[model samples]
Target: MKTFSAFAASKPIASLWDDAQAASMSEPELLLYRSNLLGSDLRITNFGGGNTSGKIDMPDPLTGQTAKVLWVKGSGGDLGSMKIDGFATLYMDKLQALKARYRGLAYEDEMVAMASHCTFNLNPRAASIDTALHAYIPKAHVDHMHPDAVIAIAASEHGEQLTRDIFQGELAWVPWQRPGFDLGVKLGDITRDHPNLKGLVLQNHGLFTWGNTSKECYENTVRVIAQANAWLAERSDVPAFGGAVRAPLDRQARLRVVERLVPSLRGKISGDGASGQRKQGHFDDRAEVLEFVCSQDLAPLAALGTSCPDHFLRTKIYPLVLAFDPERDNLDEVIDGLDGTLEQYREQYRAYYERCKRPNSPAMRDPNAVIYLIPGVGMLSFARDKTTARIASEFYINAINVMREAQRVDRYVGLPEQEAFDIEYWLLEEAKLQRMPKPKSLAGRIALVTGAAGGIGRATAERFLQEGACVLLADIDANALAQAEASLSERFGKDVVASAVTDVTNEVSVQASMAASLTHFGGLDLVVSNAGIASSAPVGDTSLELWNRNMDILATGYFLVARAAYRLLQEQGVGGSIVFVASKNGLVASAGAAAYCTAKAAEIHLARCLALEGAEHGIRVNVVNPDAVIRGSKIWDGKWKEERAATNKIATDDIEDFYRKRSMLKLSVLPEDIAEGVYFFASDLSAKSTGNILNVDAGNAGAFTR
Candidate 1:
């Protein structure tokens, strides 16, 4: 349980605010400056899990009048490199009217109306739940962040008090409220009370601040967080937790637990013994337990938050505590203890709800505890979904670290049990749950694949089609494209595959292909920018033509395809995925192939930018960088490949072996291997993943430093 110094955390927040304020001086470039701030903040966070907004006093379209409007982050847009449409415009007067009303209208109704106001725009996007909060704030620019360090602190027991003590006169503290209009009204009230507050600390949530300028807002946030970090460091010593270790639970025992728990969970949990217990199904093997002993000699469990308050809906608050004793080594006892703890947790939860309930509010279901505490070890969170489980585990680990530090200062101060309950059953969040769009895993799915004449692109397209998708296959060689289409038609019928004979390098051709995809498939679900010309040349002597050619086809081509896909996907009102077929060169440069390496690297960045931009539209984008995908097609005929082979002074036949041996695992990198990675990116399994670069290089990239 390592706790960061309060100084360390608070310093960045101060610096960021200063920077943001400085950037705000240029009003004409406000949009650009704000976008840059958004991008920087997004990069600071793991993904663009945070958001930002700006208040603009604009003239009304219907009348020659000036009125304020809130331009807030849209639903699917990434904070990093956000575009104009990534923001939804809400009538400021209407928002103010809603705020004044205070409590009558439901949060869901407010959200729907706010979202509907964007109808004037050609490409309308959904408003984020925080739109109301942004609208209520007085500042011109608003920024919200989910920085890892800040979240680490907020997820702890003493988060609220620590935050208050750290920020002191400079910040305002708001209790945890579900993000929406209700939160907006609550925040509005706080703003009225603390008119001069520079930033806000939302307990168990994230941080938010606003400024007359974007720079002020950004810098203030940074400074405030830094103060908290410094306070933490001054108070306590952070202990190092031991590294990850797998549990010794056997497959049979794991199966029994899954069987017992799955029925109680909301979603169907497969992959247990009944689903033929694959390696992926074994939770114990997948789980990592990090052990930390309390250095302060305090009760370790009391220091942390009750797992993550946010994860309460998914995994119940507390875990089954297993104390380590010399006499209890039997595995059966441990399992029975776990079951008994769950039973007790359920009964206690019901009692707690009964005590806290309002007259009209319905009682919540007795939640199953998500965590398991091992006396000698720390804690473990079990979730039906891997993502939820992972977030819960991380949250627990972070909370433990913060709690340890907080105890040294003023004793652990967690949210009141009632406060936690309020958040778990917040009406605004409940409204969001009800309004959640229906799942359309691959609904209205359409895909376009470059180099789809053969190999990985072909295989990926086939997989997409199998998952109820329509595909457009593009290839430079007309005959090859036709032949590929014919073959695919025989296997998947004529309506499933559309052929486009165009070089991906040509902007017009790329645009045409994308258009054809939309026309034929009715919409686009994915874009697999797989077309690439490989080249092997040392950096200094690499030919300009060869370099330019590689860039034109691989890097620029990916950009063009992604750009077109963005338009079509947004038009269709369905989010999509973009999978770039960058080689492992994108991750780690190979010995030769300077031109190829540079292009691939650029492609990877392109995917990241697109992912950020596309998020607001429910679009997800990721890259699959494979090493030595050589199941089909000869690159020898391509000029870049021929020159590279000659430069390397080795026959093309030796290239595959050179890469295969470089990897720790002596597995050949096949098209199928790369295709699977592409499929994962394109599927609903990766709903929360964007700007991710998955390596399907058979441990090659990880094994080799460069």
Candidate 2:
């Protein structure tokens, strides 16, 4: 892999980052220059993978004098978008001194604590554990990454020989050693022995390249990767498996199996976290996963360790395989088969843990399989959140591709199971895991809210997030929905909020929203049917258009969302809550508001009917009747507000105060007040209450249920 690159040196660094510390290191900005370009390519290093380092002269804290310092990619920052501060600066001599102490330290020894004492600045985040390895290299710049093409060669059985053939003088090889102080010291030894080498490939791991200039280091990486790709491509005509007849994937049948399999699989693995608490996990069936897992050779190839040792951080060493046939079995048969498969998988995983775990290590990790391979179907990945599930899925798909390419050249081999476990459960990774905050009460639950762009919908969506539920905000107003999503995600987190443009009145649109809910967050637990409009008209004066619009959105929309969400709940075999945002106008007759009143009354009755039918399925359906809540409410906009003011002989601005005094408590009805009612029904606080009507209008006796 000795190909050359045409990369030109970047211009002088400018102050264009949120991190001021990073921008301040503008002179000799080689580290920042190289890191930016390297991080931009996902194929090179994705998410939080890879690190770059440089040697620079800076003032020393202890000596109050100028000294050479090692500035490396900080522990938690992403390289593609890293700023100057992303480079964790440490005095070279101090860091070099700590390396000797790490020689035989126990795996449980705190690497971060030892490195903390060497930091030139008191940055809170820990430095990358590979600091020593970078410092020991005499070159001006070093780049370490797990590029897929490089990993393909490292994972092959003939990887060591292939490295010798491709880049005879430019490259060197290092046998697989779990990354840490020991590995760092070994790398230093390799550098001294082979001073002329341009790069080093770590078997069953990744690649490392160094140069006197940042441009040279960057070019060496690209050229080496391109050579690996070209070499693999030259001999790529080989089939994935040796001459064996294989059956094709039944696409229709596989989809059926996926639909029937996800719910049962979710239930079996729900409570397998370290806390042993029943945390809900999301599922994903990517197109790439289907193309790979559906092949006959998947089970055998995937049974081995991950594409690289570091992948074990997301997808454990190996995946679980299950048998399924849509053509020969019913849902019950599928469930029984999964139960048996899951039990066997659990037994094998526990055995693997006992066999590999070192003494005095942290407790065994959750035994649940992150990736599942089903016969004749696609791969299914599960995790506590959508982002994690997607990460694992993407990694596995890449692994399959890498393994396939490696097999064409020679038999594919990866790090031994024990070594993979060591990396998977390493102390450095454990520290990162320990930092995760405690989960909320409804942390893993998924909620669907209609009319989420405004009024009660927005308020209820925010409330659900506060209680730890991932919410999907649905609304017909695409622009407003996008804004709501951005604001909510900023307040909460992007992973906890998703938005869908949904016309609740249309069956196709509503069904698509339901599918998105499952696709994004695994399952639906709560349905807040709050999307509707208010239309006022007496019997004779009401136009057909106004009447139909009210009925379609207020009445039919509620039915459609509830029906779609309820089916998913039943499939999951887990109880869920459905709350309808009905109106006090439904119970108390309001003249000239026939269409709005009638539609709301119908919505309340629909909730009662659903409650009766869904009771046996552990589904709860309830209603919250809010009266004249004018604040932040789109329902009270335009004609509704004008008409209210005209009726009471007051200014349009006085409409809010009029409704506030209309209630027996004489208190203003805010959107949050109504949201509280929605939350009560959605949470376990109302677990036993169904077919119930909650009056959220302070003291509206006229709208109260008898």
Candidate 3:
């Protein structure tokens, strides 16, 4: 195996402190800046895996006299992306007062509410359980982090000794204890008892460092973690992970395997996603990941589970290792046996829960594994949403680092089983879970929208995003796609939205979009086959090229898009919805526009055909026929508009108003109006309806279906 990273081997964590930058900042801004610098590097700490605090003087609300307050990272906030408001402020005096109310370890949970009462100025952000530890440290600034290098030593059997040896007695070591009121008091006593100690290591936990100022605290934390990394490097002479049991499969080969496995895996895990609350997937096969998954120690280490409290909370107690061998040609067989293998893992999890439940533990969460290790390919992590799924894979990478470094010096150790459970099902943690806002309507749904760079396609993509779906926007125009992607990504985060430059008329291009969807997110749940073209001409004047152009884009493009998405939807085995945006002409005859009318008619028929064939797989296909959508219509841009204006003997600029008057309801349809139709069909609101048509044509009598 490849050992630690080259940068990690060097072990120099240069201080990014700028005196010029720090000179103008107030204490709170400095704390935020210090935190951003620390979280910028994953080597310092994993995302959302650490807390930083600063004590500052602020005037009391009740009285004008100045008072010192503790400002710490709020619950569920990531250090990297948080704003000043993300910090929960509590009066230091009120925090100190809580110590008298502490009823010991058995009643530690009551302290969470007790701490909330200590809030300064009625700050809405909730304080985390780690609040007590920060409050009791007795320092102006404190930083508690779960760095891989530090955790490596923390998880090793000889960690306490290593802490003593490496720090030369400057840093101290505390045995494993869950964080709460008792642990906080103990930490306070330990620091007060040993005034010379700069910081300490908590077994199976993390490092806590303090200083007179925020800068000092930040530097001290980095210095200690750097020392640990260098010390481990000097001793790591042997190959990591028992020298790797098999070589990694090449990239293309691995993706091919992943494309096959992820769909089937997602389908089985989602259990049909009928609730619209399903799992989205993220996969990683980086060098470190490949080394670990292809290693001899993979099984034993994975079974022992993660060590840090933050790590195990995101990833479960153990990962389910798939029965796959990269060296053999047995992928087909392994895929076939996934049901049995997953069942065994589920049974093991059930047994663990049964063995560990206290009188009032929160009922078991989704029994399926969050992390799935495919020996040759890489790691697959799934969660209720895409960003979380990606975060799970990232956290596991940290676990891999911990295992690698611990093995280099001493045998790795995990937390005691019952202790792990206590953290997992803690009542405070359960309350946090309950407090989470309800998920959005399309939360966990993944969709691909063709012609999404502008107009109706763009509108549909935005609609999906607004309701909590990850969208892959596809358009043949690269520039337009880039612009659309930037706008949407800015509105909804970049993680939930991606784009692929695709010409849906090409079979290969359409298939590549599916692969792109799988690569960006796990698999496909919805397909909007909306790419189209419009034309109008007398039969004699309309060239065969014009006829074929309409046929190619409107008819063939829809077919290619449907066929590709159907494969992923079927493989995923989870139910899916496909909404095709045809046109009013699909059902209505028009003068001198036979080619355009026939092509749209064919598009609508295709959806009905797909609705028939897809029913067996629980895939619903429906159509939305939009007419005279002048605003933001890519079809109304040039030739089609002129041809239509001439056909109706109207002026070019008045086409929109003309259509408005033509509709029975006299409504001028906009792209956003058409999007509402797509949303209705794609969402579970239409879960029971299939092979249906919803028209956004402003009461066009010619196109009404009987």
Candidate 4:
């Protein structure tokens, strides 16, 4: 809501932005930095959704002393694709001075002061409005982005209240306001208040936090956003827009509209179009209908915009009106009516602010709604330029869709009016707004592994943790499950692992396990249906109980787990991945193992079916078949072991060699190797792959024998 003058100057900080991009820079260092930033930023936001900055000291030509400058990402640059040039430099001393005087000066004055101090050689590219905030950070590097999940929660009714409840004293909350000096000053003040605070949350705005180093900042951001995301997801009421007609707008038009509106509304926006069209269509006819459509539906449309509050600078709080009519088309009347609609919108916004503000807070200028459209007429968003407007419109549309759906569950609830005010005026959160930390690739991701007490399952859990994923380890054996958790915790730490005693054969147990996984990780992403009982019994001699048990775990268990994962993953909307751990018996027959073979074969087929069914929901399903993994397993200690020894007329020691030499490779396959295959299927590397049955049997099945 804070507006600054266009003529405001930006003062650069000393020792903040100057860094050598010389040829001598280590390739590994460069690659590491780039990859780290890219991965972290991308996870925080969608493609090109966030920004980053680094500070370095340069030798002052006259003083010979190091001066700091900030190298911030330029507008329109994606953190993922940002190069050294993508950053704009600002003097550190000037920036810090601006923060000191920020309380008394108008936002425009602050900007002018800062801009006047830019380096002579630096191209006169407009510094990001958030430059002052970035300068206030003590860290050498900073990254910022509007993560979709985090913003979705922050933009909702009671968002501020919920944030305060979840984060408690850990975070600073800033109210929704335009980004620039006013926001920076407020943030600076708050940061001073909470010296140890890891991050700041702008109510109805995006998140911001920094660290002494890039990795620290990135990790902190991931952890904080994850906390918010988990909290919100738990309380959210996202619904399935079942069999609804997809939006009718062309992709190009959608993007163009978003780009234009983003700067005007000052928010980030992205998502599918169905919701936007539906919301825009709600106000079919009006000269300023575009703005009305963009603005009036702020709560519902929160999802499509930059996830955080500060995005409003790019998109504006609302779009301008084109025209409005419930029934017919009248583009000319709508266009002519823009001025009046805008006036009305401004008046209403001021009234809303006045009604909501506390005695201590200063009132913000009422900006016109970000959207306006007339029925049967094209809609447009007004902003400083087309790109900003387009971004705003896109985000607005997306928010509308979310709002409409949320309405089905509960009338679109947004942050309480007081909470919104607090965030809009929060100084500490604004100060921390310099750069957001990058999110871990797997920060909010969830994984569930059956038979997790076994070596392969445990290994998979460990690997997932290393990649930043939260894991739910499920097993039928209570003692084994407990021990697995203890072992995994010792290796990977406690927060990364959770264990559930699950009997996959039981539908209720499967359901409970999945629910626990969701509760533990906040959402479901990957599932490893690896729990199965192996037995060696010939066809006629196999007990009915044995056959049923085998089928229950290997076949029916897979079906149940897949079904549970699919439901939760679909609810999440991000594509999910699932891997079924079958065995060599699935592909090749073996004597005295009818039930085992049948169960394995059914599991493989079940996975194929799930892959087909899950594709519609963006869930990938695959199978991994491993043969004779013998590391710390009861499979070599129980009845099956005795039976195998008797039937094969050999000691258990020789039995191991017997299975190993049966394969062409004559190599002993380890459980970790199978775990590797599971990882491949569970990650983005195999995004396009599904319905695949990968053989990890040491080439035992032979090469495509006809």
Error of 3 at 317 (Å): 1.1
What TM-score does structure 2 among the candidates reach?
0.86
TM-score of each: 0.50, 0.86, 0.97, 0.45
Q: In model 4, state the lDDT of residue 490.
A: 89
Task: Tell me model 4's lDDT, rounded to 2 decimals.
Answer: 0.60
Candidate 3 local distance difference test against the native = 0.89
RMSD of each: 18.3, 5.2, 1.6, 18.0
Clashing pairs in 3: none
lDDT of each: 0.61, 0.76, 0.89, 0.60
* Deviation (Å) of 162 in candidate 4: 26
Q: Report lDDT (Cα) of residue 516, candidate 3.
A: 84
Over 390-474, each residue of candidate 1 has an lDDT whose tens digit, in order, gives 5555555445544444444545445567766776676655766668665334433567899898688788877877665667899
Report the error of model 1 at residue 117, Å: 5.1
Give candidate 1 regions above 4 Å deviation.
1-50, 64-67, 75-84, 103-123, 146-165, 174-186, 189-195, 203-206, 238-316, 319-366, 371-385, 427-431, 434-706
Give the poorly placed runs of model 2, Cα more than 4 Å off.
Answer: 1-29, 100-112, 241-260, 271-290, 325-336, 374-377, 465-468, 476-509, 539-552, 605-618, 651-653, 663-668, 684-693, 698-701, 704-706
Better of 1 and 4 by lDDT: 1
* Model 4 error, position 164 (Å): 26
lDDT of 2 by residue, 1-706 (tens): 1111111111221222334444555534767877887877766766677889878787766678988878898887888888887788877888788766663746425655688888876765568777767878777788998777778788889889989987886888888877776677778788878899988999878889987766677777767776776676666555553322333345555555555566556656763323243343444444435544555466677787675765767778888876554345555676777767777877888888889898856788778788887654667777766556777776776676567667777778967988877777776678778988876666667799999998899999999999888899999999999999999999997877888999998999998787667656666788999998876666898899999999999998998999988887887766789999999987887887899889999999999999999999889999999988888987687687886677567999888888888789999989999999999999888989999999998787778689
Q: How far in Å is the alpha carbon of 44 misplaced in model 2?
A: 0.7
User: TM-score ranking from best to worst?
Assistant: 3, 2, 1, 4
